[model samples]
Target: MLDKDATEFDGACHCGAVRFHVRLSEGLHSARRCTCSLCRMRGAVAVTARLGDLHMLAGQEMLTLYQFNTGTAKHYFCSRCGIYTHHQRRSDPSQYGVNTACLEGVSPFDFEDVPVTDGVNHPSDGNGQKGDGIIGVLRFQSVGC
Candidate 1:
């Protein structure tokens, strides 16, 4: 059952091979970018959503999962287009970190001051390795629009 009051945002992979709708639990206030080796390379802004808040409207088969390190985190992407869509956060299993850029009419650059999570020293790693702790929030404004 879908919540009538929930805000719905349409999303699709780069090649339109995968599509889905995100019914935000509380709008989109929880967007952030991670600074982990994998995340930094991927370079995508993720917003918080409960596992139930996300609904796969189509292309479930085109989605592929990838895990690394301790395999605690599950990353999902479109197998056809190779576009990362979302992932289950290792820090909070209950939260699904969604690719903010996938949202319709939304661009990572449109966001101002996005907080950076210190994945380099994740508590789950227990490696005693630590990042500077939230390097900073990035701010950007789309130009010529």
Candidate 2:
């Protein structure tokens, strides 16, 4: 059972072919971005969540997993729509990083001053860098209006 006060949010692909529900604390939904090669190419803005907080509301069969860079993280996408929905972050296997853009009500445009993290120097142990640990927060503002 999910906490009654938890912030329940919805998200989907650009073509609306994929959708999911995410339950997280209000302030906990802040976005993050990774500098890894794959993450850079995908332009993904991540919101961390506990594994159990994420629920595949629909289109389970359409989802596909992509693994690379030592196979540390499992990037999940909609196979049919080719949308990166979420991923099991390499830095923390126990957490799920959902794409904030995929969420329904939350527009990337509304975020202000998303923090930047340094992942290029990330720890080689596959745990990612130590200081603050996050590589960056690619908010809508950073992407341009």
Which of the numbered candidates is closest to the native, going by highest lDDT?
1
- Error at 2, model 1, angstroms: 24
- Output the lDDT of residue 10, model 2: 84
What's the lDDT for all of these models? 0.82, 0.72
Candidate 1, residue 123: the lDDT equals: 74
Number of backbone-clashing residue pairs for each candidate, in the order shown = 2, 4
TM-score, structure 2 vs. true: 0.80
lDDT of 2: 0.72
TM-score of each: 0.86, 0.80
- Cα lDDT tens digits for candidate 2, 30-129: 5666676786788766778888888887888888989976788898888877989999877678888888778776655556645555656667665545
